[model samples]
Target: MTLSQPTDAMHRKGTIISVCRIGLHDIPEVLSCGLQDFLEKPSHYFFALLIYPVIGLALFLWASQGNAWHLIYPLLAGFALLGPVAALGLYEISRRRELGLEIEWQHWFSALRSPAFPTIGMLALWLLVLFFAWLLTAEWLYLSLFGSSSAPSGPLALLADVIGTGRGWRLLILGHLIGFCFALTALGTTVVAFPLLLDQHVSLRTAVAVSLLATLKNPLPVLGWGVCVALILILGSLPALAGLIVALPVLGHTTWHLYRRLVRIDGSVAIDPKG
Candidate 1:
């Protein structure tokens, strides 16, 4: 992803980002290839999902030991925000796979050591800010809706509050609506931004703009990708979130392949419209 400096780019010192036109069909193709890649080197990708089980296990532990079961819901919903950051490892694995190199434990952990480290760091900070903002918004929503009554004494009380009354119904509906907004914003802005920064020495601004343009150009695939991510997250949330141990790395690798398919050197996908 080394670039020739011609002074036309703004995001990095000498690189241009590409935004390729894609279609709904490209979605499955990219995902299938990515899953194959993950399966090829299951160990590295397993370490990628290792982070999920750790987070899931810790959250489950806290939920079991504390009465704040309600607190876990917001954190779980915000997983999508942290997901891109989490997938940094998988991105590294995917990058290594594409380069025909064997994975090394020492170098694989060095995702932050890219020449584009500053831009990637800035993007990560921005995502973290969005995550905290979502958390605060969820807290404010609960407080505004139920005031002091919103606090649940236990897991059953929390369950009842979420499904037992009109206020409960209101909270559930509104909270999901707000969470969807946050997730959608994140999806649009970061669907390819992180991968682009990982794969190329591009500026944060270029990476983001290219990501947005790619989404806008390929609405159907992006829409499908969003649905896929949400469905996997929901499935992962079941069984104490253990499913994420398998789902996250697969999807993380899928996202890298998606970026590969969605961007081209000249900002156009080499696909036949009628194919």
Candidate 2:
């Protein structure tokens, strides 16, 4: 598809990214819309196909180490932080479907060819850095709390330590609070930026500015959206991450619809496209 067709003079000057007001009610609505999109285009094979490499990489990194169980919770929780990057292809699917274009697995590569690809890469890099930072922080916290002791032997032993000890309880409370801060940062930075970059020809600054503004305008709903995503991801992770084969695509599609609801691009302002 022609992702970079030249726009009118107003659009060339840059379109205004308008943030719309929404409510807690919009969260469920967008989720319902996302599920409908998933049902309409059940791309189970598509996501299942893509996830294998990630699983392989994770297995290579942690599977051989018996003591890696301490970081398992952190790794699972950090999935939300990098979700925007993972959902890029799914966004393209939703975008094409929304525009009544024919869908194909080939079209999943559309993000790679977008005019905003470099900027998209930059935003994705930011998320990657955030993900690594989270993992480091989690490791440090674990060391600070229980490093003096030997690492737990397996998932059950680790679970017992966490649920059976005072320091473990402290880790639980602090880890979640710290994790929430990271999640909020990610939500504000990318809640609109990634989809906007995919849907429009805009600079990184403009897309990010609009995303932050949209989150500010609808703080409660956006927060609710983050919470809902975390809950779903947690539940999806329960079945050895097999559930994500469905959960990730559905969430990805829902995010596109949520972005449509949260922002309205208008020909009112001039933004520098190069930024």
Candidate 3:
């Protein structure tokens, strides 16, 4: 929250962030458009998304080396909490393509030069904090169920403890329930805020407020989108996190088009930058 008090006056500049209600059908349409965007520039998009697999492998190695095998699932599932931040560059790529600009790999970093970078940084920090909070909550939940001293020897041992006994089922049910709450918070807050800030001159508060309104207005479609994302990330994490090379870009590019459908900017003309 590095935003100063006077920054609130930016809202008085008369920018109107409006939310639109959309049906479930719009989900596939946006995904299709996002696929088209990625296909048009697959090499550039894939190169830009290499960070996801790299991070996944790093996390896997860290968990393995530390014998924190119990954390492997939580750490991987927690990725959804940070997905919006990871996809910032992809949003910029989709934005450039929308404007019919000739794009290069370097353009993925365009979000860094945005007028709203400070605000975007603040939002990204919030997501990071949320991610760590989830990890801690997950650890606490495991400790309460199995005691702090009971560390499993490996992934197999961990799986046996989690799936073989009654407490294991309890952990599974309760863990997923709690994880759902964290995921919902991330979705409701930033599902559209990041892209809106990048695409418009609106204040952070206005952008987040509009994002929440969009979620509330279109709960069914938004929820479906979240479910789809969770499933994709789960599948992508299968091959040593290699699947994200495709999952990340498609989800990232689609998110921009999704934001376009969810929120409409008014009162200020959105400028298309020229090279």
lDDT score of residue 24 within candidate 2: 81
- In the range 128-231, model 2's lDDT, one tens digit per residue, is 89989998999899899998476888878888999999999999999999989988999998998899888886788877777887877778989999999998
Best by TM-score: 3
Against the reference, the lDDT scores of all candidates come to 0.75, 0.78, 0.84
Off by over 4 Å in 2: 1-14, 44-66, 268-275
Ranking by TM-score: 3, 2, 1
Q: Tens digit of lDDT per residue, candidate 1, span 1-275?
A: 22222212232333345566666777678778778876886765566577777886687578657755666788888877888888877877777777766775554556767767788889889889999999889888888877855578777888888898888798899999998888888888888998887666566877888777877777777989998888888897787787887778778889998887776544323222111
| RMSD over all Cα atoms, model 1 | 6.7
Error of 2 at 16 (Å): 1.9
Which scores better on TM-score, 1 or 2?
A: 2
> TM-score of predicted model 2?
0.88
